[model samples]
Target chain A: MNPLIEFQGFNKFFGQHQVLADIDLKVQAGEVVVILGPSGCGKSTLLRCLNGLEEAQGGSLRLDGQELLGPDTDWRQVRQRVGMVFQSYHLFGHMSVIDNLLLGPLKVQKRERREAQAQAEALLARVGLLDKRDAFPRQLSGGQQQRIAIVRSLCMNPQVMLFDEVTAALDPEMVKEVLQVIQGLAREGMTLLIVTHEMAFARAVADRIVFMEAGRILEQNHPERFFTQPQSARAQQFLEKFSFVESLPKTLHKELS
Target chain B: MSFDTAFMLSTLPAFFKAVGVTLQVGVIAIVTSLLVALLNATILVLRTPYLWRLVKGYVELARNTPLLIQLFFVYFALPSLGLKVSGFAAAIITLTFMGGAYLTEVLRAGVEAVPRAQLESGRSIGLSEGQLLRHVILPQAGILSLPALFANFVFLLKETTVVSAVAVPEILYTTKNYIALYYKTYEMLAVLTLLCVLIFLPLSLLLRYLERRLQHGQFGH
Candidate 1:
C-alpha cells in the first residue's frame, strides 16, 4: 500500500540553525510509528511539520499524495486530517471538558450544537471521562486532561494522530492510564505517529520504530529487531542508556538470553 | 463651614441626578475602552506591522501623559483648530482612550499567558484564525486577565472624576457647584463621599467575589 504520509528530504531551519536536515521518513496507513530520540534531536519538530505547525524550508512533504509544502497549500485544510497532543495537555483551560471536545466540531465543522454535544458525550464516555463533562480542565488530573485532549482531537475525526511526548508531564502513576488509552486507539486501527521516551510503551505499540538523532533518522526497524539489534551505533548507544528492566519486551529478553 | 441641613436636603436630588451622568460616562467609556483594548491587543499579538506600531505608540502616549492634559487637549485645545468637542464628549473620549491603553497591557498579558501550545492545538484541529481567536485564545485570555480587568474597571470608574476639570456636570462637578452656591463645604463633601462610597464599594466587593470564584475554578457565572 502507498504510504499515507511521506517526508522526502525535508529540511527545517531556525535562523541558520538546522532543526531538521534532509529527513526522509514514511508512515503507512493504520500503522503505528514511534520516533525515539535524544532530546533536541528534532523528533517533535518532525511531528509539528506534518501538521504544518512548523514549516519545512526544503524538500517535498506529502499527506495522502497531496503536496503539503508549497505556497498553494492551505495549512488550515492540511491540519484537518492531522491531530496532535502536546506534553502539557493543552486543553482549553477555561472550557469544560465537554466544551473543549465540542469546540472543533461546532466551530470548525459548523455542526449543529446538539450533534456536536452528542459526539462529545460519546467520546467522553469512551474515555471514561463522562463525569467530567461539566468540569473545567484545571479541575482534572494531568492524566484525565491528557485523555480529554486526546478525545478532543478525536472529535475532529482526524485521519492520523500525532502525539508529542504526551505523557512526559504526567506523574509515573498517571502514565499507565494514558498509555492504555493510546493503546486502545492503536488497536482501533487509527494511524499514529508518536514521539516518546517510554520504551516499553513504544515497543508494545509501535509496528515500526524509527530512531532519530541530530535532525536525521539514524535507524528504523520492527520493534523486536530495533530493541534486540539496533543497526546503528547511535541507536545502540541510545538503547544502552535505558536499563534492561523487567518491562523490556519478551522478544528482546529472549534475544538477549 | 458648619453643616447646612436645608441646603444639603435641597441639592440631594441634583446630586442624585448627576449620578446618572457619571455612570453613563463610566459605562460607555468602559465598553468602548474594552473593545479598543481587545482590538489593539489582537493586532499587537498577531504582529500586524504598521498597525501594531501605531497602537503601541497610542498606548505609550496615553499611559505616559496625565489624563487631565489629555482631557484639556480634547476639550480646550481642539477649539483653536475649529474642532469643537463638548465637555461630555471630551470626557468620554479621553477616558476611553486612556483606559484602552491600560486595558491593552492587561489584555496583552492575558493573551500571552495562554501558552503557545493552546493555539497550536486550536490550529491542529483545523480552526481558522478567527475561530482560534474567538474560541480558544480570547476566552482563556479573558479568564487569565479577569482579576486585573476587574480592578481596572473600578479604577476607570473612579477616573471619571477627573472629568470635572472640563466642566462636565458629573457627581464631582455637581458637588463643586453645590459648594459654590451653598458654601457648606463639610455637608456637601459628606454627600459626595456618601455617594461615592455607595456606588463603588458594593460593586467592587461584588466583583472581588466574582474574581475569587473565577480563581477557584467556579466558572458557573
Candidate 2:
C-alpha cells in the first residue's frame, strides 16, 4: 500500500534553535505507529508539522497526495482531514460534551443539527461517554475529558488522527481507559500516529514502533522486534536504562518456567 | 424659609425637557463609542503594519488629552475647516471618539481572554475568519466585555455633564440655567445629584443581575 503520510528530510527551527533536523518518516493507511522518546526530543513538533500547526522550514511533507510545502498549499483544508488530540485535552470549556462533538460536523461539514446530533450521540456512545453529554469539560475527570477530545476529533471524520501523548496528563488508573479507547480505534482500522512513553500500550496497539531522539528517527521496526531486539545501540541502551530489557527477560523466564 | 411651590413646579417641565436631551446624547454617544471601539479593536487584532500604528496613534491621542479639548476641537476647529455641526452633534461625536479609545482597551482584554484553543477549534471546524469572529469570538467577547462596557457607560454619563460647556441643553446645562435664575444652589444641586443617582443606580443593578444570569447560563452556576 502507498504511504498515507510522508515527511522527507524535514527541518524545523524556532529562531536560532532547531527543533526538528533532517527527519524522514512515512506512515501507511490503517497503520498504527508509535514514536517513543524522552521529553524534548522533538516528538510533539513532528506531530505539529504533520497537521500544519507548525510550519517546517525545509522539507518535503505530503498527506495522501497533497504537498504540504508549496506556497499555495491550503493548510485549513489539510487540517480538516487531519485531526489532533492534544496532551492537555483542549476541549471547549464553555460547551457541553455533546456540543463539542457536534461542532465539527455541524460547522465544518454543514450537517443539519439533528443529523449532527445523531452522529454525535453515536460517537459519544462509541467512546462510552453518552451519559456525560451535557457535562462541561471542567465537570469531567481528566480521562473522560481526553476521551471527549478523541470523540471530538472523530466527529470531523478525519482520515488520519495524530495523538500527542493523550494519556500523559491522566492519572495512572485513568491511563488504561484512554489507552483502551485508542486500542479499539486501532482495531477498527483508523490510521493513528501516537507519540507516547507508554511502552505497554505501544507494544499492544502499535503495528510499528519508531524510536526518536534529538529530532531524528533512530530506529523503526515491527513492535515485536523493536522491543525485543532493537537494532540501534541507542535503542538498546534506552531500553536497558529503563530496566525494560531486564524486566522483560525475567517475566518471560517466569512464564516459561 | 417658606417652600416656593410654584417655582419648584415650573422647574419640573424644564428639568424633564433637559432629561430628554441628556438621554438622547448619552445613548447616542454610548452606541457610537461601542462601534468605534469594536472597529479599533479589530484593527489592533489584525496587526497590519500601517493600520495598527494609525489605530494606536488615534487611541493614544484620544486617551492622553482631556474630553473638553476633544469637544472644543470638534466644535471650534471643525467649523473653521468648513464642517459646521450642531453643538449636540459635535458633543456626541467628541464623546464617542474619546470614550471609544478607552472602550477599545476594555473590549480588547475580553477578546484576548478567549483561549487560543477555542480559535483553533473554530478554524479546525472550517469556519471562515468572519464566521469565527461573528459567531465564536464576538459572542463570548461581548459577554465577557459587558461589565466593562457598563462601567464605561456610567463614566460616559458623568462625562456628558461636560457638554454643558458646548451649550448642549442636557441636565447639567439646565441645572446651570435654573441656578442662575433662582439662586437656589443647594436645592438644585441636590436635585441634580438625586436625578443622576435615580437613573444610574438601577441601571448598574440591572447590569450586575444580567451578568450573573449570563455567567450561570453560559458557564453554569
Candidate 3:
C-alpha cells in the first residue's frame, strides 16, 4: 500500500541557513512515527513542513498521493486533514472547553452544531474531561488544558495527527495524563507523527524510531533495536544523556525551545 | 456686562438642542470608524497582499494630518473637485476617516497582542482567515482593546468640534453662531466648556460600566 504521507528530497531554509536538507520519509496508514533528536535538530521543523506550517523551499511532499508543495496548494483544506497539538496546549483562553473543541468542526468544516457538539462531548469524555466541558481554559490545570487541546484537534477528525513535543510544557505529574491520551490514540491505530524528547515514551510508543541530527535523518529502525543497539554514534551519545537522572527544574529546560 | 448670566442661561437651551446634532454625528462616526478600523486591522494582521500596503498608507496619511484639514478637504476641497458633499456627510466622513485610522492602530495592537500560538493552533485545524478572525482573533482583540477603544470613542466625540468648520450646525456650531450674533464670546465659551463637561461626564461613566460588563461577560471574572 502507498504511504499515507510521503516526503522526497524535501528541503527547507531560513535565509541562508538550510534547516531541512533533502529529507525523505514516509509513514504508512496507522503508523506511529516518533522523531528523536537533540534540541534544534530540525525534528519539529520536519513535522511542521508536513502540516504546511513551514514552507519547504524545494522537493515534493505528498499526503495521500496529493502534492502539497506549491502555491496552488489549499493549505486550509490540507490542514483539515492533518491535526497538530502544540507543546504549550494553546487553547483559546476566552472560550469554554467545548467551544475550543467545536470551533474547527462547526466554523471551519461547517458541520452541524448538534453533531459537532456530540463529537466534542464524547471526545472530552474519552479524555476524562467531560466535566470540564463548560469550564474556561484558565480554570483548568495545565494537564487538563492539554487534553482539551488534543480533543480540539481530534474533533476535526484529521487523517494524521502531529504532536510537537506536546508534553514538554507539562509538569512531571501532568505529563503522564497527556501521554496516556496519545497512547490511547496509538492503541486505536491512529496515524501519528510525533516530535518529542520523552525518551521512554519514544521507546514504548513508537513503531519505528526516526533519529535525526543536524537537519538530516541520521537513521531509523525498530524502537527495540534502536534502544538496545543504536545504529549511529550520535544516537548512542543522544540516548546516554537520558540515562542520567534529570535534576534541573523543568522551568530551566523550558527555555530550550 | 456683568457676565450676562441671563443670556448664557437662555442659550443653554440652544446648546441642549444642538447636543442632539453633535450626538448624531458622534454615534454615526463611532460606528463607521469601528467598522473601518476592524477591516484595516484585519488586513494588516492577515498580511492581505497589496491591500495591507494601501491600508498602511491610508493610516499614515490620516494619522499624521489634522482632523480639521481632513474635514476641510472633504467639505471644501472635494466640492472644488465637483463632489459636493453635504455638511453632515462631510463631518461623518472626515471624522470617521481620522477616527478609523487611530482606532485601526489601537485594534491592530490588540490583535497582535494575542499570543502567536493561538493563531498557529487555529490554523492547525483548517480555520480560514475569517474563521480564525471571528472565533480566535477578534474576541481576544476586542477585550484587549476595550479600554483603548472607549478612550478613542471619547476622542472621536470631542473631535466633532472640528466639524463646525464644515457648517455642520452641531453643538459648537450653534454656540459659535450665537457668539457671533450676540458678541458674548466669554460667556458662550464658558457655556461651551460646561456643555462639553456635561455631555462627557455621563458618557464616560456609561462607557466605564460597559467596559466592565463586557470584560466580566467575556472572562467571567
Candidate 4:
C-alpha cells in the first residue's frame, strides 16, 4: 500500500542556515511516528513542513499521493486534512473554549453552528473538559488549554495530526493528562506525527521511533529495537543519556554492534 | 469700556447654537474617521507592497502637516482644482482623514500587539485570511486600541476649532463673530476656554473608565 504521507529529497533553509537537509521518509496510515532529537535539530521544522507551514526550499512532499510542496499547493485544503498542535497552546484567548473549537468547523467547513457546537461538546467531553465549554482560554489552566488546543485541531477532522511538543510548556503534573488524551487518540488508531522529549510515552505509543540530528534523520526503527539496540553510534549515545543502557537487553546489544 | 456682561449674556444663546453645529461636525467626523481608520489600519497591518507604501505616505502626510493646512487643502486647494465643497463638508472630510491617519498608527500598534501565536493557531485551523483577520486579529486589536482611539476622538474635537478658518459657523466661529461685534476678545476667549473644558473633561474621564473596563474584560478581574 502507498504510504499515507511521503517526503522525497525534502530540504528547507532559513537563509544561509539549512534547517532540513535531504529528508526522506514515509508514514503509513494509522502509524504513530515519534521524531526524537535535541533542540534545533529541525524536528519541529520537519513537522511544520508537513503541514506547509514552513514551505520547503526544494524537493517534494506528498499527502495521499498529492503534491504538497511549493506555493501552488492548496494550503487551506492541505491544512484542513493535516492538523497541528503547538507547544504553546495558542488557543484563541479572546474566545471561549467552545468557540475556539467551533470556529474552524463553522467558518472553514461551513458546518452549521448547532452541529459544530454539538461536535465540540462531544469532543470536549471525550477529553473530560466539557465543563470548560463556556470558559475563556485564560480562565483555564495550561493543561486544560493544551487539551482544548488538541481538540480544537481535532474539530477540523484532520486525517493526520502533527503535535509539536504539545506538552513541553505544561507543568509536570499537567503533562500526564495531555499525554493521556494523545494516547487515547493513538489507541483509536489516529495517524500521528509527534515531536516530543517524553521518552516513556514515545516508547509506549510510537510505532516507529525516528532519531534525528543536524537536520537529518540518523536512523529509524521499531520502538523496541530502537530503544534496546540503537543501530547508529549517535542513536546509541542518545539512548545512553536517557540511561536506557541499564535496561538494554543483552542479546539486542550484540545484534546492534 | 469694561466687560459688556449683558452683551455676553445675550450672545450665549447663539454660542450654544453653534455648539450644536460643532457637535454635529464632531459626531460625523468621529464615525467616519473610525471607519476610515479601521480600514487604513488593516491596510497598514497587511503591508501590501505598493498599497501599504501608499497608505504609509498618506499617514505621514496627514500626521506631519497641520490640521489647518489639511483643512485649507480640502476647502481651498481642492476648490482651486475644481472640486468644491461647503465649509461644513470640508471640515468633516479633513477631520475624518486626519483622524484616520492618527488612528492608523494607534491601531497598527494594537494589531502588532496581538500574539503571533494566536494568528498561527487561526491559520492552522484553516481559517481563511479574512476569517483570521476578523475572528483573531481585529477583535484583539479593537480591545487593545480602544483607549488610544478615544483619545484621538478628543483630539479631533479640539482640532475642530481650526474649521472656523473656513467660516463653518461652529462654536469657535460664532464665538469669533461675538468677539468681532462686541470687541470683547478676552471675555469671549474665556468663554471658549470654559466651554472646551466643560465638554472635554468628562470625555477624558470616560476614556479612562473605558480603558479600565476593557482591561478588566481581558483579565476578568
Candidate 5:
C-alpha cells in the first residue's frame, strides 16, 4: 500500500543555509513516527514542511499520494488534513476553550453549530478537559491547555496529526497527562508525526523512530533496536545525553525514598 | 482685570455650541480613522503586495506632515481643483486621514506583536487569510492596541483646534471670536481650558476602566 505521508528527496533551506537535505521518509496509515533530534536539527522543520508552514527548496512531499510542492498545491486543504499542535499551546486568549475548539469546525469547515459543538464536547471529554469548556487559556493549567490545543487540532478531523513538542513547556508533574492523551491517540491507531524531546514517551508510543542529525536522517529503526542499540555514534551520544535527564527523576525519587 | 465669573457665564452659550461642533467632528474622525487604520494595518500584516506599498506610503505621508497642512490641502487645495468641501467636511476628512496613518503604524506594531504562535495555530486549523484576520489577528490586535488608540484619540481631538482656520467654528474658533469681541482674553482662555478638561476627564476614566476590564478578561463591548 502507498504511504499515507511521503517525503522523497525533500530539501529545505533558509536563505543560503540548508536546513533539511534530501529527506526520504515514508509512513503507512495509523503509524506513529517520532522524529528525534537535538535543537535546530531540522526535526520540527521536517514536520513543518508537511503542512506548508515552511517552504521547501526542492523535491516532493505527498499526503495520500497527492503532490504538495510547487504552485498548484492548495495549502488550506492540505492543512485541514494534517493538524498541528505546538509546544506553547497557542489557544486564542480572547476566547473560551469551547470557542477555540469550535472556531475551525464552524468557521472553516462550515459545520452546523449543534453538530460541531457536540463533536467538540466529545473530544474535550476524551482529553479530560470537558470541564474547562467555559474557561479561557489563561485560566487553565499548562497540561489542561495543551490537551485543549490537541483537541483544537483534532476538531478538524484531520487524517494525520503533527505534534511538535506539545508537552515540553508543561511543568514536569503536568507532562504525564499530556503524554497520556497522546498515547491514547496512538493506541486508537491515529497516524502521528511527532517532534519531541520526551525519549521515554517517544519510545513508548512510536511504532518507528526516525532519528535525525544535522539535516539528514542518520538512523531509522524500530523503538527497541533504536533505544537498545542506536547505530550511529551521534545518535548514541544523543541518547546517552537524554537518558541522564530522563532517568534523573526516577533516580532522585529512589534516593529520597 | 479682576477675575470675572460673570463673563465666563456669559460666554457659556457659544462655548456649548463650539463644544458640540468639536465633538461631532472629533467623534466622526476618530471612528472612521480607527476603521481605516485597522484596514491598513491588516493589509500590511497580510503583506498584500502592491496595496501594502500604498498603505506604507500613506502612513509615511500622514505621520510626517502636520495635520494643519493636511487640512489646508483638503480645504484649500482641493477646492482650487474644483472639489469644494465644506469646512466641517474638510476637518473630518483630513483628521481621519491623519489619524488613520498614525494609528495604522501604531496598530501595525500591535498586530505584529501578536504571537507568531497564534497565527501558526490559526493556519494549522486551515483558516483562510480573511478568516484568520477576522477571527484571530484582529481581536488580539484590537485589545493590544486599545491604550495606544485611546492616546491617539485624545491627540486627534486636541488637534481639532486647527479646524478654526477652515471656519468650522469649533472650540478654538469660538474662543478666538469671543476674545476678539469682548477682549476678555483671560476669561475666554480659562473657560476654553475648562471646557477641554470637562470633555476629556470622563473619556480618560472610560479608557482606564476599559483597559482594566479587558486585561482582566471581562471582554465585551
Candidate 6:
C-alpha cells in the first residue's frame, strides 16, 4: 500500500534550540504507528506539524500527495482530512458535547444540523458517551472528556487520526477505558499515528513502533521484535529503564517467538 | 417655614417634564456610546500598526482630560471649526466619545480573555474570519463585556449632569432653574439626588444579577 503521509528531512526549531532534526517517516493507510520518546523529544511538535498547527522550519511534509510547506498549501483542507486529539482535550467550553462533535462536520462539511446531530449521536455511542450529549466538557470526567474528544474527531470522518498523549491527564483507572476505545479504532483499520507512553497499549495496538530521542528516530520495528530484541543500544537501554517495562506474558512471548 | 403640600404638588408637572429629557439623553447617549465603544475596541484588537497607534492616542487623550472640558470643546470649539451641532447633539456626541474611551479598554480585556483553543477550534472547523468573529468571538466577548458596559452606562448617566453646563436643559439644568426661581435649594437638590439614586440603583443591581446569570450559564455549558 502507498504511504498516506510522508515527512522527509523534517527540521523544526524554536529560536536557537533545534527540536526535531533531519527526520524522515512514512505511514500507510490503515496502519497504526506509535511513537515513543523521552519528554521534550519533539514528539508532540512532530504531530502538530502534520496537522499544520505548527509550521516547520524546514522539511518536505505531505499528506495524501499534497505538500504542506508552501504558503499556497490549503491548510484548512489538510486539517479536515487529518483529525487530531490533544492531550488537554480542548473542547470548546461553551458548547455541549453533541455540539462539539457536530461543529466540524456542520461547518466544514456543511452537513445539516439534524444530519450532523445523528452522526454525532452515532459517534458518541461508539465511544460509549451517547448519554452525555447535552453535558459540557467541565461537567465530564477527564476520561469522559477525552472520549468525547475522540468522538468529536471521529465525527469529522477523517482519513487519518493523530493521538497526542491523549490519556496523560487521565487518572490511572480511567486510562484503560480510553486505551480500549483506541484499541477498538485500531481494530477497525483506522490510519492512526499515536504518541503515547502507555507501553501495554502501544504493544497491543501499534503495528510498527518508532523510538525517538534528541529530535531523531533511533529505531523502527514491529512491536514484537522491538520489545523483545531491540537492536539499537538506545532502544535496549530505554526499555530497561522505562518504569512499566516488564517482559510480556510467557504465552505472548511464545507467540512472538 | 411652613411645610406646604400645595407648593410640592405644583412642582410635580415640571419635575416630570425634566425627567423625560433626562431619560431621553440617558438612553441616546448609552446606545451611541455602546456602538462607538464596540467599533473602537475592534480597531484596537485588530492592531493594524498605524491605526492601532492612532486609536491608542485618541483613547489616552479622551480618558486623561476632563469630561466637562471635552464637552465644552465639543460644544464650543467645533462651531469655530465650522461644524455646527445642536446643544443636545453635541452633548450626546461628547458623552459617547468620552464613555467610549473607557469602554474600549473593558471590551479589549473581554476580547483578550477568549481562550486560544476557541479560535483554533473555529479555524479547524473552517470558519471564515467574519463568521468566527460574529458567531464565536463577539458573542463570548459581549457576554464578558456586559458588566463593564453597564458600569460605563452608569458613569455616563452621572456625567450627563455636565451637559447642564452647556445649557442642554437636562434634569440638573431644569433643577437649577427651579432653584433660582423658587428659592427651594435644599428640598429640590435633595429630591433630584433621590431621583438619580432611584433610577440608577435598581438598574445597577439588575445588571449585576444579569452578569452573574450569564457567567454561570456560560460555565454550565
Per-residue lDDT of B1-221 in model 3, one digit per residue for the tens? Answer: 57899999988777877899999999999999999998998899879999999999999999999999998899889988889999999999999999999999999999888999898998999888788888888899889999999999999999999999978888889989998899999999899899899999899999999999998777765
DockQ, prediction 5? 0.50
lDDT of 2 by residue, B28-131 (tens): 99999999988889889878779888989999999999999999999999999999999999999999999999998888888988888777767765567877
Best by DockQ: 3
Distance from true position, residue A230, model 5, in Å?
1.4
**Candidate 4 Cα errors over 4 Å, as ranges:** A70-72, A239-257, B1-9, B74-85, B183-187, B207-221
Q: What's the DockQ for every one of the candidates?
A: 0.43, 0.29, 0.69, 0.43, 0.50, 0.29
Candidate 4, residues B1-221, lDDT tens digits: the string is 58777766877888888888888898899889888887887778877778888989999998999999999999989988999999999999999989988988999999999999888888888888899988999888888888888898998888888999999988899888888887889889878888889888998898889889887776454
Better of 3 and 4 by TM-score: 4
What fnat does each of the candidate structures reach? 0.70, 0.33, 0.78, 0.61, 0.74, 0.31
| Better by DockQ, candidate 2 or 1 | 1
Deviation in angstroms for B31 in model 6? 1.6
Candidate 5 has an lDDT of: 0.91
User: Which TM-score values does chain B get in all models?
Assistant: 0.91, 0.90, 0.92, 0.91, 0.92, 0.89
lDDT of 5 by residue, A1-257 (tens): 99999999999999999999999999999999999988999999998899889999998888999999979988998998999999899999889899999999899899999999999999999888888899888888999999999999999999999999888898999999999999999999999999999888889999999999889999999999999999999999999997776567643335555
Please identify model 6 stretches exceeding 4 Å from their true place: A228-241, A244-257, B1-9, B213-221
- Please give each candidate's TM-score: 0.89, 0.89, 0.85, 0.88, 0.90, 0.90
Lowest-lDDT window of 10 residues in candidate 3 chain A?
A247-256
Instruction: Residues B1-221, candidate 5: write the lDDT tens digits.
Output: 49889989988998889999999998999999989997998789879999999999999998899888999999989988999999999999999999999889889988887898888889989999889888998889878888888888988888899989999989999999988998889988999999999998888888888787986673422
lDDT of each: 0.90, 0.86, 0.92, 0.89, 0.91, 0.85
Clashing pairs in 2: none
What's the residue-level lDDT of A119 in candidate 2?
A: 81
The worst-scoring run of ten residues by lDDT in candidate 4 chain A lies at A248-257
Q: How well does candidate 2 reproduce the true complex, by DockQ?
A: 0.29
Off by over 4 Å in 1: A111-119, A244-257, B1-7, B209-221
Error of 1 at B108 (Å): 3.1
